[model samples]
Target chain A: MWERNPVIFLLLATAVIMVGTIVTMVLPFAYVNTERDAIASVVPYSALELAGRDVYIKEGCNNCHTQTVRPLVAEVIRYGDYSKSGEFVHDRPHLWGSRRTGPDLARIGGNYPDQWHYDHMREPAAMAPGTNMPPYDFLDNRDVDPELTRRKMEVLGFPYSDEEIQALAGKTDMDAMVAYLQKLGSDIPWREQQRVTLVGELVNPFAGDPAAIVEGRELYERNCAACHGSGLSGGFAADLTALNYPEEIFFRIIHDGIQPLRMPGFATLGNERLWKIVSYMDSEQVAP
Target chain B: MERPAYNYDIVKHFVHWSILWGAVSVLVGVVISFQLVMPQLNFGEYLSYGRLRPVHTNAGIFGFAVGGFFALFYYMVQRLCRVPIWSNGLARFQLWLFNIVIVLSAVTLLLGFSQSKEYHEMEWPIDILITVLWVAFTINILMTIFKRREAQMYISLWFMMAALIGVAVLFVVNGLSVPVTLFKSYSAFAGTNDANVQWWYGHNAVAMVLTVPPLAVFYYFLPKSTGVPIYSHRLGIVAFWSLIFMYLWTGAHHLLWTPIPDWVQTLAMAFSIMLIAPSWGSVINGYLSMNGQWHQMRDNYLVKFFILAITFYGLQTLQGPLQAVRSFSGFIHYTEWVPGHVHMGTMGWITLLICGAFYYLAPRLYGRELYSIPLANLHFWLVLMGQLIYSVSMWIAGVVQASMWHSLNDDGSLTYTFMESVLAMYPYWWIRGLGGVVYLLGIGVFVYNIAMTARGAQASPGAAAQA
Candidate 1:
């Protein structure tokens, strides 16, 4: 009867279940805490960013978008630096989600400007067409509740001053969300961004071709004209016609966008076409 | 002597309410599955996929699955022990508390109050409520088992005991939090530790809630419907003991290739492979139990449900360990493949077992024959087709998505943009959506059959006793 007794049976069962729990979970608790540190650049989320994180949690963006980049070749290329454990030290309930209906947001920090994230959140399709992400347009209308943000910071042990919390008073959740997105992987340097330079012996295959220059003008109009202006005049960016650098230097500059100026490199357009664009640039008379 | 009357009215309420929750689960599920395909369907804060996904899971697992388990356990315990349920008043109290907790969970979740733990998502207040409700249930079951008229406990009782204790330990340990506000709390652990603990709780929640409970119901009800004892009680004991021991270690399999400790991942991987043994032990036991009862499979609709349910359990268990391998986890961990794997457990195994248990209990509870076996067969076929299409489509989608994400152009650049991958999934998502609709239709048939059965039921003298 004792062998079949339900009380004894359950006691033994509970004990059996605990052995694994203790080994896998509890034993690790002995050392896992004191051995880790936050990334050198990781500070607690700023007031607005913390508030944005709350909105991210509230809206369940983690449901579709993961924040971790695994250490794989293509993954590192697609999303910047692979995720590190130290990078998430300040994360409370880590937004390292389990699904990816959307792309990983781990290193999305500097991938785009704040305006881009704002527009994307407002209407995802406008920025990246055919995306399945629902428009979070309502976030732009919703104010960040400072009381809850303060409370949340206190709970997560993120230090903040009253002034810092107050700065977020009238900001919209959309602003907060963008702040959060931009701050994501800023703690670590991302070497995998398209922000690379072409260094080596360079030969422009299209340097002397007048036909290439004509085609480059058309390509430039479609791709670069929006920011760099038509007719080699400046709009949001530098006046290209005033530049007097060698054609190879021009290729390097275009291959590596002026990072501080926010010009994007057209690396995906490949070497042949960018050289053509350079040919058009060299053919143009200086706008003196 | 005639058997003493058990508190069957409580069983009736639990079964009926769980079915209601199950319907909500299916309805929300269909909506969210389509939301993956159609972004326009996500209505702002409340009805969107994020908030409602938890609502769907909470309702389905805790609301529907757990509720059905309660109903079946209550029914089976009384008969297996050869005694009446202990404390009818406590059982009644538990029934109300269960429904209240579920309602609070659904409301609070829709309002965006969550712990953000996958299965254990309800806020602190609701968590406390759930704890109290579970305790009330556990004590009552324990007390009943303590005073059994039968000297030797059945294999089903052992399973029920494990589930009761296992859930209590897992829930309270993982649910530990520090409350910041009324609706918010932080996980007691942080960063990597938090990830480790969450998946430990997350995956084991499946083991304790989904696996063990259904096995209890299955072990008891399989023989009851088929009119044969399980092939080997000793085999059941070995399988039961090994399964409970191994399941807790395997939770870290979900954390493979992640930031959790290397040894922990390796341990989890090893134990996960070993788990296929005990899981199959139960599967083989079920198959062998049907030795001479093969003829019943043809004539008895209930037998078909049990056999199919066990078959899916076998398939799910096999697929789970295979996915846990580091190489395989690399491919499918975050893809639609994981969900496809999970639905096989939920939709194929657990739901089928719950439906079978409900069907078996309905005639006995309501004191009438089932409305129609043909409709039951129709319901079965629809759900089967629906689940196959849903899982298979997602599996293909996961493979395609994995390949696209891994593909490289000649320049060593990614071949497809992430948008291109999402766009490619559109057709499969449509098919998955249709599968959900068909599954929901099958459940609609089930609800109709049960409702009609109860409508014409001339309240049995045994069932008429007031709680």
Candidate 2:
């Protein structure tokens, strides 16, 4: 026998670990189940949609398109809603693919016309200037007969009949993928939310005009002094004077939107509203 | 001097065969790198990047590195303990079975049967075979340790024991599965729990099997080749225990910024940062052991490789923990920086140490002089330069790609599309291909040197073999 000393230790430790493993909850301690939300308009994939899904898998399209939406400011601004567990209920293998070689396709549904997606896939650079994605010209009519697509569907376990194929819309290579794409982000209700608010309501400008030194100090003291410091010392993001960005850069960012980052472009605010915020920012000078 | 009888036959056999597989690994690695640069190099399905990747990894880790370690361990253990192996028959069986396992792993992976886990890509059946093989080998080594005639256990023995037990626990736990079919299986643990365990096993697989075992060889061989005892055995023990304690908790560092619990990820990140202490402990120990004996680095080809290997290990460990932090992980986790980190361990640390150990063992084990030390030194420089070029270029490529992807225009949209970032990596990929060719050339030289050495000349009676 190999000396019993460590064997005893192993046995005791194994028992403790085995018991801990069994009793320690195999599921993550922080899980919050979110699969039960309801969707009024969503429906399960029709037979034709199922065929399109098969095409998606066979083409290795999952390598490029991601389905999952990360919970970040940029993701929400760029891709619409953050992914919820309920969005994946109908998916059998859950195509929340990891790599973003192309773009997120969770909400690509109806985002573009069928021909655009078709021509894009066939020769990606034809549509986008700097694309490295290999052209899927193999899916063109010359390479793939309509009959072969039917045969390929059989291997993928879709029980589609010729009659169903005859009834499909937009008869081309793009039609199949677009059918899958059109369903991407159609589930979220916030897609049509239309609201616009004034900039002055959100940002305070106590100082009358930014060019007027006395007025600028008054605005700076009231609105920006506490966080930026009385002299506009470094706050969380950066000291205001430290920013060497051009006036146009600040104007565009303050009014427009930056996706995936917390920095929202200020495009929603008017030109005069952004100038007021800039004026107050220029007036504060930190001692350092 | 009362010379202890060493089992040279098995050592000779393992060293010879390992050099063969080492060539295969480097050759495959070179071809794969070429395929990335020129897609025309890819022959359809069987030879694509998808299939060749596992072959490169398995050949490097299991076929070459592990085989070299096996040969060295067998040789070192017998002499260190002042006794014969507890079971030569078991070890011989292990050597044969080990080759079978590597061959099977290579063939099956090429045939497109994979579990799809990064390093542990072998399917369920092969995983079981590996587990059984490891268990048998572990039993034999532990039994030999049990029967040792030496009074006090050396620090190398402590590392050997940790590797045996650590790998057993890690391999078994991470490999737990519910098989759906012959080659397919779902992890028994699901979701973030699964990711946690997988990385836990994944990163520590580097530690226990790749990291500690090679350090054991370095610590033993460095002093032994120079005929000097270690500078401080007690320091080596401290490094060993600290490494064991910290390594397990650092696995979830890979899952930073993901859905895994904030606390778990933070804990792993913290432990990974703390890991630098133990890692450098061994590095410092290796260098300090070389005090006033730096002259050997010039005359002794084996010491050159050994010293350089430890230096690389020190750099690799420092880089690894820094990358594990959340801020840095955000930039590099899924990028070319990731592969750069891995190859440093594989090409720089593990390969260099194995080369030194093999060169030292070949002459004594085979009772012949090394055919050429100049050729061995030549091999060392080529591989060293090649690996450095490969890793550095990839690291720069990954950082540039990541920063581009994360960059935003003032208008709040991404400055570069995903395609533009990928386009930037092609030149780096081509450079990496060139670097791999250089490394493969080095392996070719090494294999030739070993083959000629085995058949070359006899040593004088009772004389130590020359490098």
Candidate 3:
């Protein structure tokens, strides 16, 4: 019975399987376990962003959207700079998905305003025609559970204060999702930030002029309001009312929009109408 | 020697339940395939593609494939060893545990309680249930092997041992995590490390679960079906050892061209290329075993499945290694090509072989001849057409998608935006979804054949024949 023991066969098989396991898995883990490379710019999610990420995970967005940008020449051009390994250090269960049914979201942060994400999620087909993403309008009706968010942050080992955790209370999944989307890749200065060609005379030519404001409203409604929202808040574009910027920055952006993000330039309107729209935007409330 | 009264009832029930699960998995697959094209098909929260995609995978892998593994392993172990199952009680317990875990897995996944690791998505509580079930299975099978009357173990036994040991190790090591709530947990590793560990588990889940068990079933049933012993048991042993050795290293291939360390990717790619040899080793063994039995392909419907399944196994291994190559991976890593590759293995190689196994076992267990060979033939044609259509269309889609993504204008700006790349997939998605419908129809025929055999057949293979 002892001759050519099956235990020996079992042992041999176990040994063979372990050799690869140790080499591929165990060694790298031991050596690189200490020196992690979370890039200098990367940081942990705040309370509401973490809550949004939880909603993202719960909805299984990773099934369709990948978070990592590959280091390919074309890919870099398509979705901004390639994703860095260090940027994902705070990711516990890493959402670097294997498929790309949708676009990569590694650099989605600061790419659009809060309102764009909200409208896009609520009605994806209306926002982008010829796409098949199911609408997520139900998120507006549901609020984040603060206790659960607190427990999740603790579980993920993220640092959060009570105040930060409390900020999630009464916030809808839409709000949290928007916050997370806007926070995503904010660490990096992507194309949208770098492309603004600031020239002199930043002030709007029609600043505080009532007649220009009225004319600007018509141009803004015709050209920008569909994307920028009728309230000058936002839709498919950034929330213009949130930030304060001079007219030259606005002039350049309006005349030469960020094409890669699919934002079109309205240089067709000419300088006068463009500045009138800028004046109209400048006169509007910057903060809700 | 008197027969040990090999238990057929356990094998019978396991086969029956597995076929049901397999049907559920296929039905869900068809629905989700359409959901990708016509997003309107995605109904409510629980029925959407995101929630049900995991349901499709889990039901297929665990509910269908793993259930099939249990059934086939029990059947093969007893006959190959010339001994009855070591503990009928353990086997009975395992049958229930196996099913409950699958049900709980489907429900939990549909509820969106996922840890989000591909292939290993079940959270901590369900994970513990799987561990208990695995432990019970391991103990029973090992005990059966230990007490076998036969001295020289068959090659299927070798493959079986490798699967048993390999899955236990892979599942446990990868499942290491710190649980926050009963329903949730965080991987012990993070970011790059988490990715490295996941594919190590993820890809090897293919090796141990998908490849090995089906190979074990194939080796057992092929010779049984063809009425000829395998050409070389020695080749099977060598292949089994080498195949087990190499497969574990190739998991990192999934991480190729990504953020993980470069050397790991190279090592994974090399091992992946080398893996074709051992995978083909069994394929060659199966082909050469048919040396005198070439006429069986005409007379025997079973031979059609075995030959084609092994042929697919050959093709799948070849495709897998080519995909692992750096340039090829860069082009099609996240494209539809990967899904196409995976389904060829699952639908073509694994499911075909196991369906053949079930057909072979159903008659013997039910004590009756198969209800209809024509329906079996119908299933064979339908599934083959379905798999071919699915894989071929997706392969075309992957190439087209990759080209469009890589396409650049002469001035060097992107020629197509991400949305444009998505728009190009519509035609192929429709074709792929149609293919899924064909595959599901084939599985429906399969389930009907097996179910009718249970109800229609009265003649039984006695306890003493093979026993």
For chain B alone, what TM-score does every candidate structure achieve against the true structure?
A: 0.97, 0.96, 0.97
**Distance from true location, Cα of A237 in model 2, Å:** 44
How would you class the docking of model 2? incorrect
Candidate 1: list runs displaced more than 4 Å. Answer: A1-3, A36-38, A190-288, B458-467
| Candidate with the larger TM-score of 1 and 2 | 1
lDDT of each: 0.84, 0.68, 0.84
Candidate 2 lDDT over A1-288, as tens digits, reads: 212344653454344333323322233333522233435555555445654564564444553466655555444555556665445445533454334545678766655445556766666665554454555554454222345445544433445767765565335444556667766766666653411222433333334453555554554454344334565564443356666554445445554533333332433223444556555554443333
Candidate 3 per-residue lDDT, tens place, A1-288, comes to 222367988888899999999899877675443455546667888889877886787778888898878888777766666776777777777888989999888877865555667778988875566688998887898888899778878877789899987777789988998898888777765445433234555566666689998988876776677587886877666788866776677777886676457465554344677789887877784665
Q: Every prediction's TM-score for the first chain?
A: 0.76, 0.51, 0.69
Residue B20 lDDT in candidate 3? 88
* DockQ of candidate model 2: 0.06
TM-scores, each model vs. reference? 0.91, 0.73, 0.89
Model 3 docking tier (incorrect/acceptable/medium/high): acceptable
Best-first order by TM-score? 1, 3, 2
